[model samples]
Target: MMENKPDEPVDHLSQLPVLRLNLHELAREQRTEQGQLALRDLTRLLSALVAGHAAVQTGQVDWRVRGYTHAQPGGDVQPMIELKVSAVLPLLCQRCLQPALQRVQDKVLFRLVEQEPGLTQEELEAEDEALCVRVAVDIQAMVEDQMLLALPLVPMHEVCPQPIVVAGLEAQPIDLPARASPFAALASLKKGK
Candidate 1:
């Protein structure tokens, strides 16, 4: 049996777990934050997101996200969250079909819209990064979405492990026994009749 120490005390804050946050509330309060997270926690979420992707390797990379939520400029009262995500992941090179390291870095600034907008041209063209935060936001999911979007359209090694070679079919002629044409048979039957 070991003796209990009275002098030392545990610091719980440092060991506290990170939880999903309400982006709207954070924005309302106007705060700046930063944190580091492991890929292990997001295995299932990422598996579904990257199912068809060649580089579906998971649990090797770590993510770092930094952001600040504040009122948008130009006298806009609405809040905007600007976030940056950085990570390095192992991806399959399309050229060689082998594993290669890929660096993913993305930044997004979103102006939180309270109500879902009706069908409009601006909503159609809102690809520049704007999201409506009506409920608590899952930071992990948000970062994963950014990572998935940042994946290269065509992932390839700058210098492939092996060179790709394409072979063309060579033209060749096949020999076959000659057969009477249908018209010849028809004429023969007509003559026989």
Candidate 2:
């Protein structure tokens, strides 16, 4: 007979059956979870990938989530969640028009508040976000959103792999066709006059 324990952490991502996370329970238990999501599974993210790499089977994003409570002013307790995401994306290089591997890694802290508060000047500078309480959080969607934010506005290789050709400097002289100047006709007409 197989036995399952609620407190024990499950190391294998395959064992996790649920996609939505209960934030209230997660913060109460202060649980930490790590998993890998296949690139093929994220349809919206896959669409942003290069055409050739759209069907890549080995590409995946490694994500780790930790939930806990933070103490606020005036003896108030706040629920918080920290998410770390990392992934290597195969993107098209805008410079050489080829594939360039890019690694995207980010850590975001979200505070699950009963009501969202207006951002202060200091809060704007911090990476933390005030999130309203929800029934369930779609972990995959959060991971996808983070990955999308990490994508470069313009993907490029450090050094372009294509051959370079400098202007005003040629290895070979280009062939040219000889032609008479426009003033030649004027000279002929002047002579006729």
Candidate 3:
């Protein structure tokens, strides 16, 4: 059974391994010209982590992150900030299309890089360079990506609880008592005459 634990606070980035991120804090950071978005906004981040990958199964995942900070040469100045996160998430049943409610846990380590707009588009797209970029360390997006990556592609159990059964019309047998036809009765009367 999947346990519903209380949401813990996330003052630092390291705490995300427990349960993604503090959802409330992530939501606060996502406000834009558009009003508050749905929880799906955060899920999009999760999708990025799983995109082009097979579905995940339900279970708990343990993740650890190190070297989250960027540093400049010969100095302690780091322009880019990085964060690592990990967790486990429950996957829905693919067959019955029901919530399998199974929890699969895994450990993932990913980095988030801060993009500098000053760099030209070509420089940003250069090969052998980091591809993932964010305006700021959007904790919500990071947490979402982690959660999505944990979902299973085919999330059904070994045996489906409910199986479809087809009922044929012939399966229902109907019985009726035999009765003499009215024409037979008329023929008998003519013969007696």
Candidate closest to the true structure, highest lDDT? 2
Ranking by lDDT: 2, 1, 3
Question: Which numbered prediction scores highest in TM-score against the true structure?
Answer: 2
Q: After superposition, how far is residue 188 of candidate 3 from its true place, in Å?
A: 69
Candidate 2 per-residue lDDT, tens place, 1-193, comes to: 9666998765554554658888877988999988998886666777767766643467899999899998889998888899899988888888777787888798889988787688788868867888787688888988999888878889988897786566689898888998899899899999998
lDDT of 3 by residue, 109-166 (tens): 3323344334778756643234244333444554455556655667776676787445
For candidate 1, write residues 14-124 as lDDT tens digits: 554755777766666777666655554555435533344434434433444333455457866766677777766666777887777678787777767777677789877
lDDT of candidate model 2 versus the reference: 0.82
| Candidate 2 TM-score over all chains jointly | 0.71
lDDT of candidate 3? 0.43
Q: Kindly give the stretch of ten consecutive residues in candidate 1 with the minimal lDDT sum.
A: 57-66
RMSD of 2: 10.7
Against the hidden true structure, what lDDT does model 1 obtain? 0.65
- Candidate 3 residues lying further than 4 Å off, grouped into runs, are 1-65, 68-91, 111-135, 163-193
RMSD of each: 10.2, 10.7, 18.1
lDDT of model 2 at residue 139? 88
